[model samples]
Target: MTTDRQISDQRVALVTGGTSGIGLAIAQRLRDDGLRVAVLDLDREEARAVANDAAFLFVGADLSRRADCRAAVDAVTGAFGRLDVLVNNAGFQHIDPIVDFPEDTWDAMLHVMLTAPFLLSKYAWAHLAASGQGRIVNVASIHAQVASPFKSAYISAKHGLIGLTRTQALEGADAGLTANAICPAYVRTPLVTRQIADQARTRGISEADVEQQVMLEPAAIKRLLDPVDVAALASYVVSPAAWGMTGAVLDLDLGWTAR
Candidate 1:
């Protein structure tokens, strides 16, 4: 457990889309590392429970809306007094073939995954600039570097996020804030569970086959990533040791691209 002094001495981290899944893991990991943690999410109850008895604040809001993003950042900075780490990890899979894809869904995906990061970074930039040890870790996917069929919107959003991560890292260099993107292969999350079912229906294959043929085929490990693994990487990137690692995409992709 983090003592009061430890909390005061440690940096403050804002983990977006952190109510559950990978974001939840990242928030908990940082809290364990003695950082004051604030989670931005739509799930008020879940967020509170995740950080219960810890130095955590749950800011309930949707990040896809620009105003909501700004308000969330302000709330976090207000409560913590400074912003040290920003993890933009709130997003979902919206799989569809472009011809029949819903425009509304596409818009939602882009806004949530891409635009929201930009807004949160915008709102947090000044505070981060002042901190001199600020960090931003974007949860971009392996799709940020590679692509698959029937995942147009999701892929595009992840790619755009990589661009955001790079540009922000460069801009923050002189100020000592480091920004980097984590490109992970398929993680075993509820979000990916939904993707499995969707892939089953779309490919007219069993969900089991979706695992064997789709998700695992590209990875050298042939297994789903654990949320903790991704969280640990995010934790490291925000540490002082990662100061020189800005504008980089840290791949936890099980050597998927190596092949």
Candidate 2:
């Protein structure tokens, strides 16, 4: 779906984790589409570049902290005077068996992926409604729909994030606000590259085997998704054509969930 108003003039988007990987690709795509962009990331160097060079405002901070999340929202609102789109994309994965998972890491993952989205949305709620085109696209994973072993915390958080997306969509529908989740099976990125190595070690498999057997084996595509594929879906979700959509989970999981 699309909208009549050009994305550039409607309002602003605040994207957490916009410095790299899928986040960076989304930020660049939105900027190219003419929307004002504000990025929240922990990378100081990249933040400086984006702040100075891109069609975006950059705030360098750790999003796992509620205060930091609020600060990033403040920066977005401060820059654009209103927020039209909020993309909750900051996430990391730690692969460890449930019996061996570190307590602190588990806490951090839940806070960053799940809690941060809730806090950012709450902080940006009024501005979104006011925009009359409020949109939220959560970056969930295929694991949100199904699970694998040794990913209890990450899987749980993604599942809960989808639930949050549904609830927000229901509550915001009457007010012209829409919320949805994008679930991608596997996208090639630094994080997934790391996961490959870690999975190899954990499963006593070679990296090639992990890629073939564990990751791509489940997909009909048999190749990692392009970051742009996910970004395009996200851009559409927040557009005016998407006004009627809410409480939806859009999955681009390479048919993994088809099974």
Candidate 3:
């Protein structure tokens, strides 16, 4: 158990899928913010190679597995003595029409993107509440608010994530925990880069046309956002100043929803 004085002196954070892209950025940002950061990813060796920082703790786990999720929370708290922030940022995209979508793929996507977060939160609840300023930041997408074709699984999972975030917020209010979701437009990550080819194939268009015509068409800004753009927002969401910002679905959508 962590003492109140220890909690106030040093906070710890765990970021899922923290080896690359948005998760890596958020992990780095939290580490820089003076928090002891732990990264949970599927590939332990890959994560160890990417997060080569002495200060950052790296734990590998397949979030799609319930056992892994429980063990992951245990690993973090066991190593750091407490968990103050949880960033559910691990996700992937599969672009295919519903008729052609693989049932297994849908299950796998939901397992990683939606169910994993719930399991992590359930296992980490006590440790988080103990910190007395726990924060849960879900890296949802603009798809949570509106949908795009050929991304049924991703959009559905994101929509469900928001619901989970809200429920967590309500339950954690008295425990001094806050849950919020960050809904951003398309971001420049390996996940989005991979989608270029997938989108081109699904839409029967040139790969060059995917970014402008498919990805950025809905956003008024018409550009992919950097991972750091999200990291900055997440940094704020987990900060001491954001205590009152619970159950908020924050849109860093580049005006995608403005219209």
Candidate 4:
């Protein structure tokens, strides 16, 4: 348990899309690490649920909207008084071939996955820098490095996210802040669960086949990654131990990238 003194001394973290799955896990991990935690999600009812059940503050916002992104950051800083760690983990996936992918869906994906991170980082920059030990951790995908079929919008947005992460790291180098991205493969979260179902439908395969042939085909490790596994990496990225690492991409892809 973090004491009041520890909470006061530790940095506050605001996690976007944090009401459930990987984002929620990351929020819990950081909260357990003694930081004051706030979660931003689009669902107001879900936000209330997280606040009540997890004891973390929750703010409602749609990451696809720039105004909502800015409002989320303002709400967190207002509630916590300072924002020091940012984990840009809000994302959704729409699996469709380039020829059939919807234009609006593509726009939404880019806005949420790429633009929202940039806007959040921009809004949070001054407070993070003022903290004198700011850390930004972006939860990118293995797709960030390697492309996959039928995920045009998702792949493009993730690749762009890594670019944004690098830019943030370079710009913050002299400002007592660091930025990095974590690229993971097939984590067991709602997003991946949805992807599994989508892949099954798209490829005319069973969900089990989606897991075995589609999701695990690239990774040496056959099992899906647990949420805590990714959360542990996020925790490390924002911790003092990672102070020297910036503009780096930490791969937790079960050796998928090594190939």
Best by TM-score: 4
The CA-based lDDT of model 1 is what?
0.89
Q: In candidate 3, list every pair of residues with a backbone clash.
A: none
* Local lDDT at 258 for model 4: 81
RMSD of each: 2.1, 3.5, 3.0, 1.8
Model 2 agreement with the true structure over 40-100: per-residue lDDT tens digits: 8885885678656775688887877888888888888876678989999999987789999
Sorted on lDDT, best first, the list reads: 3, 4, 1, 2
**Candidate 3: what lDDT?**
0.91
Question: By TM-score, how accurate is candidate 3?
Answer: 0.92
* Candidate-wise lDDT, in order: 0.89, 0.88, 0.91, 0.90
Tens-place lDDT per residue, model 4, 1-259, is 8576766687899988888888999999998998889988886775778776999888888888889988898998888789999999898888778999999999999999999999999999999898888999999989999997888999999999999999999999888799999998888987779878987998999999999887898889898999999999999889988889999989999989887
lDDT score at residue 107, model 4, on the 0-100 scale: 97
Which lDDT value does model 2 have at 113?
Answer: 94
Please give, for residues 19-118, the per-residue lDDT of candidate 3 as tens digits.
8999999998998888988998876676788867645788888887889999999988898788999999998888789999999999999999999999
Ten residues in a row with the worst lDDT in model 1?
46-55
Q: Is candidate 2 or candidate 4 better by lDDT?
A: 4
lDDT of 1 by residue, 1-259 (tens): 8576765667989998787889989998998887888988885675677656555788888877889999998898887788889999999876668998999999999999999999999999998888899999999999999999888999999999999999999899999999999999989898888889988998999998998798899888978989999999998999988898999998999999998
